[model samples]
Target: MPTIPSPRHAARRSLFQSGIGLRLALAALLSALVWLTIAWALAT
Candidate 1:
């Protein structure tokens, strides 16, 4: 007989992958926002 994986394990793995990607994207966005804000403040 063959063995099968559980649904809970699969869901957890997918969630972990998505969480890492989301964090990276959020960090990039935040840095860009801060840089732009600083440039605008200096220009004014």
Candidate 2:
């Protein structure tokens, strides 16, 4: 029989999923866009 993953193991797996380099780059790009929008709003 296959054993199930415990809560901690599941959480760790998800953390690594988001820690991928491509995902990190995408997240950074999205954050930059949001900051730019906020800056433009404040300027106007």
Residue-level error in angstroms, candidate 1, position 6: 7.0
For candidate 2, list the clashing residue pairs, or say none.
Answer: none
Which residue pairs clash within candidate 1?
Answer: none
Name the candidate that leads on TM-score: 1
Model 1 regions lying over 4 Å from their true place? 6-11
Per-prediction tally of clashes: 0, 0
Residue-by-residue lDDT tens digits, candidate 1, 1-44: 22356777788899999999999999999999999999999999
Clashes counted in candidate 1 amount to 0
Candidate-wise lDDT, in order: 0.92, 0.87
RMSD of each: 2.5, 6.0
